[model samples]
Target: MNKNTFLGITGLISCFFFSGIALLQAQSKSADLKNWPKGSSPKEIGTRVADHFVVTPHTNFGKPTPPKVITYPESCTWYGALTFAKASGNKKLTRDLAERFEPLFGVESKMIPVPDHVDYCVFGAVPLELYLQTNDKKYLDLGISIAEKQWGPPEGPRVKEESHEFYKQGYTWQTRLWIDDMYMITALQAQAFRATGNQKYIDRAAKEMVFYLDQLQKPNGLFYHAPDVPFYWGRGDGWMAAGMTELLSSMPKNNPNRERIMKGYTDMMASLLKYQGKNGMWNQLIDDPEAWAETSATGMFTFAMITGVKKGWLDKEIYGKAARNGWLGLVSYINENSEVTEVCEGTNKKNDRQYYLDRKRNTGDLHGQAPILWCATALLR
Candidate 1:
């Protein structure tokens, strides 16, 4: 009886120890999120960005032809809008965004793009989010249908360099090792876990994140455009920064890879702090001093930093000013139309540095618009 009593008391002590740690962490995050600097507050910035998404029309996919279907950039922006609407307590905006999605469930069903690639797979996240917010099974069914296809064996022709064997190893058949895939793949999977309370989705994402960190992350904690394309492109790394943040946020504390992932995230955040431009932006080529200031990357980095500080991953005192400065600098790029500027246009991997430097800087691209809303939601959440 005494032995059993001692064991029971020890277990109780262990539980309290863990519970106390969790409480303190929660308190740390709550304090930082609530005490925002004047103009950089999430309430102010998030609302502006959310309203802008409401007013914006369907994107053209950056082409001259009309947009017949939605894509990742728009999907990301939509997900961001939903999160911001909920965080800001804007019921009208939430309903408005829901109404916007209503068409897809009815006559516009065909407009939902085929989730055959990484970009299309991300479309699932929005619907999953809709399900979470409204508790509607239609949204849940539609989203899981799309997300489940990600891990299935290849049903189509393989890309030139992609491996069909990845499915055997439990990775999505779409694995290409592109830095962008980090966000494209992990964001959807993380949402799946969030909606369903399943461990597999977050576990898979954490393993995938660690793999990407090992293979792509440079010594200084930035990634090259691709394995062969050696330049450290801005938005490319932004995808990683934001993706890591998303994965870390949803993963369980006991996840085997969590500590490694945390190390990688903090390392990258430290490096980002080193390269921040005078105006608090990261350059188009992150390591190139002459590269132009880019808004999308700046917004993404800010979002990651803000989230890190709130979650206690980063020291609040050190990252708070940097995050605030990034928010202020990023909004300065927005024009009267509420469009973000200096976004690097959609890029393909090329081994040439000049190719990246010469890529067009677009105004009002969804690539740029998506991250601002994410930053605001990060702040509000």
Candidate 2:
């Protein structure tokens, strides 16, 4: 063969070989997600989630569109990013992200009286996180303010057990016992207890878990989404599972309610073991076989189960495999841009099963990405 032809053939062969390797790498990254090195590291995955908002700074996916105001899911994602940053030892990254929500921290009405809705109270822990790291009085005051509000009145109209009704039927912030409330309020109170060394905050969170467990936990060990909603919504259970783990992490080991909380958490984990799909994912309707596999719930469950195994709350020999598989399942939904896909949009309690089945799934939604970040951080922990 001619010299030029020989050289051309050699170059073509090299290009194909390199291209094939790249393709395999990409495939392996997506496929072998449970494994590290060949797969993405937790920090790497979390950084992508953080960078998505960091670069954009104003995601239209949010209600007020970021930098202007923080919303529930956005705040959740931000806190997860902060946690991951702290865990990964990226001090500057943590501080920079925490500052983005500083303005929201100082607003009195937002933190006081519990803001009338638990959703608004979701980000209360962010200020506490910043306060813990920086020890700035402003963040500390903000956290305390939020905690005080959430603790409700000293002796006024408190949400009682009788008020636990579905569909917001006279359900006050304290009384409404949706599964989402676990994450929204419990995590904040847990952080409050941790930040302040206050037993009241811990008691409030643990007691609420006791109340909800009585009201909602089924014989199957899973929780109903709400009183009126019988279906086990994936994210709702995710909230319950993740919230309990967060509370368990901070709750005093000697507290009276500790064993009760632990049982609820472990029982929930047992239920989750039965529902995990063959692909390492859970469905939108967790008990439903036909429902599509969901990414956000998968991430939340992964975080919860892994936390359980690590803390010895769950059997590592059994749940460790599930956690690993769950992580592998979740990473598949995270695309090349670090955008998490198949995340169920923000949902409300519905009496019908199809309502949940019909919920739209979106990419890069904070509801989806936050869990991924949280799961990544948990894996590291």
Candidate 3:
């Protein structure tokens, strides 16, 4: 062959080889977890959380400032990360988490008067799961202790009135039914039921779901933040959905409330489907298209949708696309360092819609981290 012709042929062969490799790489990036690579997989997100994130001791209940005692929302990240680690089948990660959490039990037991607030007890979900995995009685004891306290009447003696006082400073401890409390109280109760095989834990969890749905769920299937606050705060609704998903997934097959819970969850999901933004995320204010896409709510919805489809509770054809897109939206917020951004910070019920709209956004907050880990674990299923 002539020198010029030989050189041209070699260049073409090299170009084809590189192009073929590029196409193969692109093809490997499938939507499902079948070929999910470690770099961006749900497992990696759990790993990042296990390696980098620390559970903050701050308390968001009843006070703006950090409290001396560790609280339940703080444990949301712990439960999420540990649950993800267990699902990933990473023994070292699980052991590391167990060690990390071991000391907290003592501290929790010695709290001046063990917290009476149901919100304070939410952290028990982690201990409950840990007990089930390792068969350790201490973990079970810790969880049961919290459950026993939360099982009683509302904190104050005035039951009906206190329950409806959404504006009270001690609403977290009171009988007040805010949308956020659904997850805070129910998640731990579900865990308690799993650990003890007691029907009461789940019964309370399910009945309370019905109660909240009647009080807060609107005509469109979305829930108001609270009776006092009329806005459909995205995270507030997300909490309700996440709680219902967890309870229904674990509730007994013959439980009388299963059908009711199922209906509520499906209805809320239908409403959520309509509000999801084009970017695969839900808005901070779900009904308000003008609000920015929020990560925590998106993560919660993605986890719920995927869980429903996998369990046959939701129709795959209808809800699967939204769930997968929601997963993509959540991971997009997770940076290489695994710091999730654009999470709406801890919020309280306020009278005006602008209060929820104007709340500050946070990064790597436990509120956001837990839902992302939950979504990651659901995708694995």
Per-model TM against the reference: 0.88, 0.83, 0.83
Candidate 1 regions exceeding 4 Å error are 1-40, 158-162
Cα lDDT of model 2 by residue, 1-381, tens digit:
999999999999999999977864453334232456545678787888787865545454544633433567876887788788888888977767866665453662342224445776766787788778778878778777767766554333454544444213312346477899989888788888878898988888888788788889898889888988899999999999999999998888999989988988888899898999867899999999979899888888989988888778887767877877787667778889889899998888989999999999888888898888888888777
lDDT of 3 by residue, 43-105 (tens): 766677666654344445435575666655567777877777778887777787788776665
Ranking by TM-score: 1, 3, 2
* Highest lDDT against the true fold, candidate: 1
- Runs in model 2 with CA error above 4 Å? 1-37, 58-69, 103-114, 154-173
- Output the TM-score of candidate 1: 0.88
* Clashing residue pairs in candidate 3 (N, C-alpha, C atoms within 3 angstroms): none
> What is candidate 1's lDDT per residue for 198-303, written digit by digit as tens?
8988887887888889999999999998999889999999999999999999988999999999988999999988888656688999989988999989988999
